[model samples]
Target: MKRIHGYVLLRESNQGIPNLLVCAFDAEGAVQDLLGARRGAERPTLTFGKLGKRIGSVLTGTDGAFELTRDDLHFEGVESRPDLVLAVLAPEDVVDPRRPVALPPEQRILYISAVPRSEAGAEEAYVIRLQQAQLDAFGIALDTSADNAHKRIAATQALLGDVEAGTQIRAQVAGRLHGRLKTQHRREVEFRDQAKKAVQLVALPHGLRAHPLLLSEASKLPDLQKKALTEGIRHLKDAHRPQLRISLRAAELRTAGMKLDRRGKPIGKINTLKLADVLRNMLGGVSLVRKDEVEPSALSDIALRARSATRTRARGAVDRAGEEGQGKALAREPGRTTAKAVKSATPRRDRRK
Candidate 1:
């Protein structure tokens, strides 16, 4: 069988971000030539078409590692230019034809490290570093849970679908007992209070599904509001068509007075009071508005118009305020004031004339 080794690297910026590299050697030694020729460039171009004949492909796991059979040889796409280097063979270059040949670089170890993107300057170094740190912390936790031998053994036995006699039966019983004992427990009273607060801003009397912004606010609702939210999201997504996505945008959340970061990102915290105020504004004009009374198409058009007007007014207000502030500052400066200052300082010669 043919074998291949490869790894993937993810980086936000070019400065200092971690990269994971895994190399596997084929038994036939054909991949060695390809690796030897790989070089580093801004965007390294690798033409697999010329390397060899087309073969099957293998996908990398969530952790960015993959192993492939000889027939599974295919090129892996890289984000940045890869410094593809061959794993140096140790002890012997030729494999024994008498038995199965061991994979070269007998131990295929993967090195996962953060490397900063080259384009990211020192000013952005801190941000990139923090992102890398968060990724690493999550990765470590996942790896620990996945690789636990005891957990794997228990999980495997549970999948067998039959309880045989002897040690296996005892083990299965213990596993089930342990699982039941570990069942999650939480106070429903506390959860209900939180859920009520989350849905408090939602005016069910008004057409919740009509406005995209309102639909977005409803999506944050907890358990009791789930059924309504599901229907609302479905209706909104159908109405919006191509622009609808699984995630909400920061601008959508800003209606609740939850500010976006400098990067225009929302961290999912809701301001209840602000949200209540915005909901009040939305429901103010409508009295007998039922959920089905308003049409999504008309509401979307109104929302777009309102947003445009708001932006225009905001820009004009800023310009006027800036001009007024500049005038005030100029009047207060030395040797600069209104006509009253010049009149008060003038001598009595004006009266003689």
Candidate 2:
């Protein structure tokens, strides 16, 4: 049995940031947790098999000290005791509101005590000093030596066999790459479809009519409709793309109603109105004739044209606005006619009936 205790000093100025410490006894537990394991009702014990081993671990309290004790010692192989501690402390100076800077890196010193079975009675105190520069160097070495070397050797071996057999290695590599790319593309498409469904579930019918810009981008079709609604309104004003603007406006009118008052006057409630408001706003404000009030028939024709444009341009918006049923109602209305028919019928009827 052996007992070891030490303190890990995380050198950071006392400001206002909390400190984090991580420690593990065995490789499995350490790798599984990555940081630290959650506290449970029963703490798991490390088992040493044919290869005799002993493992113990405990973290520091608010005081920054930890302890490790082993009742039975068995294994002799190397056991890694990796630990990381971070402390965030606010600086003394007043932080600038305009330009914010990243906090300075903290320094750490690890003090460890080990009681090896080979030297059972001897208690040794070890201090491990580490800095950012040293850690960076170690990381670079591991990546270049282990990771790069392994990848290069494997690729060389794989290509060499094909080359010796008089095979077209380049073609084979290209084919494999193409296959992987196709698989990735399919996955992306599936993910996009799933996302679009999720958005449609939350989007209100009115939002679609108010913001047509959302329907312009096919890629954005998957986002939650509410999110799309907000984006559509925002970009619609300054949008220079003619095709995109037309698509967005059409979608907005169809999905969300236009902004209008009860007196059939155009209003600035673009923020509130749905697809219906789009038609109301466009037709409501326009006076058919200058000298006297416009005829009801002429007003009805303008409304019909506006509604048709909105439906044709933005079916998604119309669907969201809950106006799909309204299309049938509008069609059933008497004296309803296309813009061309309305134009030709007016003067002829005046001269005849």
Candidate 3:
């Protein structure tokens, strides 16, 4: 009785028969003859109203079989393209053939693309568009497979747990050294430096858990080296907590992989950071916190010395100012100025000529 528009979702429901539905129109307007239509069979250009929203071609069995289905059309709401739809899959809605989908406010139809595609050039473009929409809006592009959502979530939770565990271990190790810093601070300079390198070895958050080589490297860290690193961290932390954080970050950079763009890097590739490479990079970064960290007492001494120097300079400046003022006053008085001028002007009898 009425003409409306929607996208055609052609999917195999049973027995290799692709059930076709125009999402804009209800089941009454659905094209069910797709089962009889060949894969490349000629389908009509279906449109509705004056807007001419492309509902895609209908692959009907007979030349005019589509007309009989179109005649079954009734008053149902229509939309152009993949307009978000309300999906109601409750038990009541499942049992009832006439139940309208209930869309709670602000809820969206999930990733299932209700947009119909022609059998030709539409797939790749639609895929790219969907990927872009997900990435741009949500800060992540999820795998398009409908069945992989739970697996993806599980993998994410596992990764987060690993990161947290790595952080806890790193903290525990650092704490053990910090508690005994007073006793261990006098370790040999070479030993301390080696310990710093050792800390860098274990700083790789992801690699530590993911890479077998890294675990071996961690297990091989000598006790002296470990102690040295703990002492270094404690000293740096005492010197400046921020410096310690920076050192840890620098070490992290050497040992960890950066967030890679999806376009370039393959997913699930574990980055192999070598112990030698980590040691080399650690020489620069791990020592920085130790070097930059100034003791609180040393800082206080510097302040005190600076203040004393400043006071001395101020006193000298005051003396100079006083002399300048006296000279200016004498110059302002005409008689005093003349007397001084005459005294200087009088050719000193050149006894030492």
Candidate 4:
């Protein structure tokens, strides 16, 4: 009866429809194999531990919402096995749902455990937001078709076998992908430099994931080259163990709400004002006081300043004008004066008298 319950909140903007698999695997020596499972000749299989098992699966809602409950999970022995770890399938490894996904012969049957650190409990609430940029890196397109649902389901079943293999595969893909993407960027130094700066900014607790300088500069790149660099940065982030390995329950707090205003209240529709702000908060660290704000800079400042200085200046001018008006009014009507002004005036009046 004891198990974890949660929701996977995909960003409303992501094009891909991610199918989540609740998989269980042994947390022992099998980690190595699991990390490289996506590249392995055979499906990811656990060694020296229980074979990976798919407890449950669900396709995300149109709004990118999917729920996971005890009913979704098949294994009841999760609590008894401390070594048993559950993972939500990573987007990269997901078969593209838009078309009849024909993964490369070698890449097919590979599993990527994007988030694999959930524990079994009576009831736990988790909300994970999958970014559009990251999905693009994985080549997962948005699901626009209603007929392709079964294709994805079939794809999911094709890969299910052992959990440990999926777990280990992500680690290797991260390393290999980093080298591959960097090599690709080497031909274009500009792309590499921008990507490097992005990496540094994104790693900070208060980093802006989408700074204007990067965006503007990237916008100028050839479409293919720009996409390559963007995906490169995403791969690096997807590989980061701290962000990747952070407990799912904690991730929920980090990536909450569909769309929020400056005050962090949910709005009726998508708010572009808070889009980058929300993304910045989700990547590096969660800030309760304020989201990461990008400063005016050349390369990276994260999100642009949310409040405008022009507005602030306007308010200051209004206050100064009010003070000047008060002084002019006193001069226009000398009888209407403060006690201190009248007190000083009395001495002058007596001398005049």
What are the lDDT scores of the predictions, listed in order? 0.46, 0.44, 0.40, 0.53
Q: Give the runs in model 1 whose Cα sits over 4 Å from its true position.
A: 4-20, 25-65, 74-153, 156-162, 165-353
Best by TM-score: 4
Candidate 1 C-alpha lDDT tens digits along 1-353 = 23444444234432222232233211222333434465453222333332333333333454445554535444445322222222211122234578656533322222211221232221211111223454453342234444355456667887664545556878888888876655532456667779878876554657665654444545465654676778888888785646533343455468665667789766556777766555566568433445755557757977879979999999999999999999988779686666887888778898578
Q: Please report the TM-score between candidate 2 and the true structure.
A: 0.16
Question: lDDT by residue for model 3 over 73-117, one digit each (tens)?
Answer: 322354322322111111112223586664331122122223333
RMSD of each: 40.0, 37.9, 34.8, 45.6
lDDT-based ranking: 4, 1, 2, 3
Best by lDDT: 4
Q: Estimate each model's TM-score.
A: 0.16, 0.16, 0.15, 0.26
Model 2, position 111, has a per-residue lDDT of: 22
Question: What tens digits encode model 2's per-residue C-alpha lDDT throughout 96-207?
Answer: 6675753221222122122122323323232223333433422311223443455577799988987876567667777889989899999999998899778754455775
lDDT of 4: 0.53
Error of 4 at 211 (Å): 82
lDDT string for model 4 (1-353, tens) is 34554445436733334464434443443455555655564444433233355455555554444555556556545353334444545433436577755544223222334344444345444455566654555565665574256556656776763455786797788877998888777868987788888865445334555543344455566865767789889998795665333222323433443545689655554344454455565587565665665455723433224245567888999999999999988676645777787778787768687
- Higher-TM-score candidate among 1 and 2? 2
Instruction: Report lDDT (Cα) of residue 49, candidate 4.
Output: 30
Worst 10 residues of 2 by lDDT: 13-22
Number of colliding residue pairs in each model: 16, 29, 0, 14
RMSD of 3: 34.8
